[model samples]
Target: MYSTIFSHVGKYKKEAYLSPLTIVGEVLMEVLIPMVMGLIIDHGIRKGNIGYVAGMGGLMAVMSVCSLCFGALAARFSAVAAMGFAKNLRSALFRKVQGFSFANVDKFSTASLTTRLTTDVTNVQNAFMMFIRMAFRSPIMLVCATIMAVRQNRRLSVVFLFAIPVLAFAVFFIISKAHPRFEKMLKKYDEMNGKIQENLVGIRVVKAFAREEDEKKSFGENTNSVRLAQFAAEKLVVMNMPIMQLVMYASITAILYFGGHMAVNGNIETGELSSFIMYVSQILMSLMMLSMLFIMFVISRASLQRIYEVLAEEPTITAPEGAGARARDGSVRFENVSFSYYDDMGNLALDHIDLDIHSGETIGIIGGTGSSKTSLVQLIPRLYDATEGKVFVGGHDVREYSLDTLRSQVAMVLQKNVLFSGTIRDNLRWGDENATDEEIIEACRSACAHDFIMSFPKGYDTDLGQGGVNVSGGQKQRLCIARALLKRPRIIILDDSTSAVDTATDSSIRKAFREKLADTTTIIIAQRITSVMDADRIIVMDGGRITDIGTHRELMQSSEIYREVYDSQQKGDDE
Candidate 1:
């Protein structure tokens, strides 16, 4: 896990190296200052040698300045390295998510992914920064101070033996107990974020149902769970400070009592005893810093695991070696194709289906809900691979072509039309980035979206709010159709895209498709009989199977399902 995450510290390696090196320099300078002060007190002040005192004091001042400079430089470098590490990590995660196929994406919830990318990465970054600085400095300071204390008098330094064990045991116990609590807290964070995202995305429906109180209650419960978990983890961490202080004070008392007797017997100088006490303080303080570092590592361990989980996941779909670069034409063929979202053959979403669509044919598919109408057309673009048989697009197996090459030639306006937060032209450019203004205008006209778009104050430059909230449902659908039209793909699948528009507008859009996209294979999935009645061929689907396929006139006389639906719709139109 460490290897995978730290590999992203590429350009920041220089900063990572410099941060610890500078911290070492600062620690060394600090260690020497106390020894120099002891010399001035014992040798200079006792012997009334003013010159020695003055010289040593000047050296101490220089050392303090050097220590300060090293510390400042260490802080700067550590910050740079940590921030750069986080940047690289987030970019890598986003790129990885973009590569994931629909099956891969289904494994992770959107909220969980968001939390891992943000909160989890931030936790790891902070832990890394602390590790490079304090983790390096603490051990060096502890060793240096312990050596200096032993040099003053070995008998007094023995007190640290007992105190160190007690502190170590306390730190270990607290961390071992707290780690699981922190892990639980992070999961609660994911839950809370999921709630927030759901509420915001469906705020309109939420308010319409007057469920604001219920939403608040749900959110409060999630927040309370997070709070309780955080409190449990922090309560253990807070115990560390008091345990450290108790050990430090007891060690100091033992040192003072024993050293005072040695000073009186003239075995150890007063200056040396004072310096020994200072070293004792430094040693314990270093140990305390080490404990804090350990605690941070324990907390970040959960985050690191989450991050690695995402990085380790191999994409379920990958382009084959020597894959074809371009599709041959708009023709699509499904040979005994079957699919199940859960990979369970017993619960198939698309049953064994055999169908062939010729190039430049306008095929209309009509089906009731749960008939897998959308699922059938989704296979053409290779959104989901067939579970059983082969699906061929443009005369080659769909997997035989590169994903980009195949998807580029087959444009689909999905059932749930989506538009991003951008100007009208910006959203339209998603279909064709380099399309000219004239081409964009023409596509909108073909989709019957040009009149409404021009009515806006800024026309193509008008900003659509997030999820295109600025427009009505019908307008959003029309704009999506326009965006798909901009692709000018060889095979265009409209998955009930015109359901929101009036029948007259829908007819106009279809007429425009007949004139402008005569040579393109157009597939329309709709509920309205009128929508598909004019098509060259119509398909009737039920229970994930194609029940019949014929033209409107042929189905009216032959297919009972089509006849019943058309007659009922015509009777309702007369009323």
Candidate 2:
């Protein structure tokens, strides 16, 4: 666990090492001050020597000053380390989430990822800071206090021995109980996040259907469950105070009773007994720190396990060796291809698919929902591997080429794509980092996004809200296309990309694609038969199989499914 956390903590090791050094120094000073007080009382006051008393008192004052300064410095270092580690860990986790495949993302929803990257990371950071700042200090004080108490009087040290077992037992019981509670509480937290996220993402549908009450009630149940779990864990932690107070009160009573008897009988001096009382207080305080740290351990252990889960999952689609470079003209083929998501008689997402996409051919794929249209094209980029047959790009098996090299040759506009919260220019540059102003404008033109973008007050520099929430659906889709256009990849896949645009605008975008991207191999996935009606060739799919592979007129004459679809559309057009 420690190794996993230190790895994610990226670039903070120097700060971590520096923070502990300050805490160790503070611990040393803190122990020395009490010892100084003991010597001042025993030698200076008893000798009736004014000089020795004043000198020792001044030295004690100096140690107190040093302790205050160093303790404050140690606290500053710890705060710096905690905040820095939290920031870096959250950043790295976000990067990991970005790189994860669709299957990995499906394992945890958006809200759950947010909570893990945020709340869980903060919990671990707090635990780490507490451990570094106080864990070491407490142990050092405990050991030194014990030695000082024993040296002053061995009988007094016996009180400490009795108290340690009680303290240990109390900590053990609370932590063992609380550890399971913390894990349970975090699970409930994830559940609550998942529900709330679902409600928010589909809030429009909920409101449209007047199901707000039902949604609220559903959310409330998860929320209440989380509240109860948190309350239970907190209630357990709260017991620490009262339990430690009992130990503190009992230890004090034992000290006063035994030390007073010793002082009265002259078995121990009055000064020595007074000094032992002070050390006993320090000992109890250190035990309190220990108990609090145990509680921290319970919480952090749960959080750390959650963090390690993400770090440990290796991406299944690894880039193959000797596959760094991609060919300039990207040719793709599916040789008797079949793909399934699961092993046991699952519905084939794509079945016995075969096709050859020449380097610069403008191909279109049209199908109804669940036709395996997107799945077939997605394999070319190696987003998902074929289960039973080969998918080749650039004349090599896609799995044989590096995932990155294959992807670099392909630019795809997904069905439901997102835009980050940044300027429009930033979103476009994600496709090609070195794109010039003219290139961006030219790509935007081909995507039919330039006019809409220029109409905005800030034009290309306009800030898009999260997922481009401020933009309309059509605008967002066009921007996604513009992003793909900026890359100018040898192969482009338009996955129902023009669905949001008007028919006239869709035609205009296609015309622009022909004019500007003449030499580019383009695959258009469309549900509207009109979008791909004029392609050089169209592959028509039904269920998961390609039923027709020809130009529109050829398919109309040869394939029953295509004829039926074309006849239905012609009737709709007549209506």
Candidate 2 achieves a global lDDT of 0.84
lDDT tens readout by residue for model 1, 33-110: 989999999999999999999999999999999999999999999999999999999999999999888888888888
Per-model TM against the reference: 0.96, 0.92
What overall lDDT, based on C-alpha atoms, would model 1 receive against the true structure? 0.93
Candidate 2 on 1-575: residue-level lDDT in tens? 57866675567667677767877777777777767777777788887878888998998888888888878887887887788888888887888887887667767767778789978998999998898777888888888877877888887788777788888898898988898899999999888888877777777789899998999898889989999999999898898889888988899899899888887888987667777887888889999998999899898889888887887777656776676555657688999988876633367888888888887788889777888888898888888778878987777787776766678788999998789989999999999989998999988888889999999999999999877877988988899999998887888999998899989989999998888788888899987788998898999899889888899889888988777877888899899
Q: Which candidate is the best by TM-score?
A: 1
The TM-score of predicted model 2 comes to: 0.92
Q: Which residue segments of model 2 deviate by more than 4 Å?
A: 8-11, 39-52, 199-215, 343-347, 573-575
